[model samples]
Target: MSAAETTTAKVPPTRPSTAQGAGGGTGGAGKPAVRRRAGGGAALPWTLLAPCLLVLLLVLGYPLARLVALSFQKFGQPQLWGFQEPESVGFANFTKILGDGEFWAVVVRTIVFAGGAVILTMVLGMLTALLLQRVSGWVKTLINIALVASWGMPIIVATAIFKWLFDTDYGVLNWLLSRLPGVDMVGHNWFASGPQGLAVIMLLVVWGAVPFVVITLSAGLTQVPKELEEAARLDGAGSWGVFRYVTLPVLKPIIVMLTTLSVIWDMGVFPQVFVMRNGHPEAEFQLLTTYSYDKAFVVNDYGGGSAIALVTVVLLLGVVAVYMRQMLKIGEVE
Candidate 1:
């Protein structure tokens, strides 16, 4: 072969561009360093959050742990500078409380009171919301201001007000009743009896709690499409029918939420019962919360009080679980 042709054959073909090389490198180049900066960046937040987590552990977690531990121990007498070592009694305290007839009675009363208060509050709240919706100008503003003011007042203050209102001798309620025809026993001590005291407490609870329900339901009412109600009315549905078929279905979720909240709040109510009756006359009007307080503070029975607190926690958790399950079912339906 000619020299030129021989030289051409000896030369190798031109290689592909550097970008086209396998793994983005020529044979001599090392693999590109794998960057892991994103992972380090992500971990920076958790590092920053470590202090918050420590603070939470110190503030909230430690106290809850202590409470759970103390619930198992008997209330020991105070020492020279601090509380003595609690008597370790396992589940004895719990068993004693569970078997007590009085405890069971108080539980029943609490349930009844909570149920009654929730029902009354929801009904009154719905009515109030509807009324406020229909009204306008000064009246609406006035009513809203009053409801908000009542709701904003401290529970202790509200309870004191209720106590004075139901007072036998100097109460405005009894004084007003004295002027009514055929009402002779106007000076009757309302809190002296269980039923009357419970009634007063229930009324106060309803008054305070109704505002929350009203606000929630009123918001829900605003979200309900008015066209649906108008269409229902056009189809010969009366007020009741329109509400039943259109408004209620739309408002059901909010109603359920309000009812559950009301139940939870009323179940734990202590101020009203404590300030009004002091669980007085007997334990007839005693609720679980007040009973627990009396056991812990009044009678100085910490073990029994802890047991009651634990039971209340369990019942409230059960209620929350049931509500969540029902909400899940509702979500599934939707």
Candidate 2:
């Protein structure tokens, strides 16, 4: 029973420590270490996200605040903060814009244009997505490349191309129409009238927007489980039946998202119309966005422009509110 013999006897048998055993021990020595390790690991992720948060605040927050402030002021005045400053006109500008007949016309035109563009883009995009899903190899690659190429092109450049294509005289479209059977005087002035101008604008907007919808829908399509689709087919479902019952329900959320985003994008469309017709012959083809620009810059009426911008913001907010309500209802069902 000497000290050495006692120590050797006590060390004779023992169990190795485990995670649970270590944590459960009386002194709780391992718990703090475990927590520290977890906290240290979390820091990396937050560090990685820090830059993005900083950029978002710097790039988006500042400009948005300035825009809101600008909408409340008169033109040619120094802004109380950064950039321009204008006199406070209260709601006078808003009232003036609301009273203007042309403002309502532009608003209606914008809504119709955006609505039509979203519908057409969604339809075309969905069809293209389904078709592409069924194909593979080189053909799929080619299609993807073409779509991405169009999407990657600059908006101004694309509008310029469309402008040339639809030009009234000495344009390729007019030239092609001249050769068609039973068609004489084929060189129609595409932007000479409101209807024609709006149609051209719609084409441009849809063309730019369709690729985005296609990319988003195609990604969502990839997430859809193939077995469910196969099961529907095995149950004597035709293509339409399969799509209506199986695909549509599954894709509804994404479709709604794409549609909402498309509407927002088309509503703010300015460059195409501005570049194409300079707000058109008599500004008949002017949209809310272009109208705002004209009011502020063209006519040097900053107050009216601010009022127009404020109204546009309200309209957009209303659209967003409606979408949010619809989304909540959809969520409730699930």
TM-score of each: 0.80, 0.81
What lDDT would each prediction earn against the true structure? 0.83, 0.83
Cα displacement (angstroms), candidate 1, residue 185, comes to 2.8
Q: In model 2, where is the ten-residue run with the lowest total lDDT? A: 76-85
For model 1, what is the alpha-carbon lDDT of residue 83? Answer: 64
lDDT of 2 by residue, 1-334 (tens): 8999998988967776786677786777797898899999989898999999999999988876776776677765344233764677777777777788988889998899999888899999999999998887688889888989999899899988998898777778888878889876466888778877888889888888888788888888887788988999999999998899888888888887788888889999988888887544357778898888887777777667767877888898888887888789889999
Q: What is the C-alpha RMSD of each candidate to the true structure, in Å?
A: 7.6, 5.3
> CA lDDT of 99 in candidate 1?
91
lDDT at position 304, candidate 2: 75
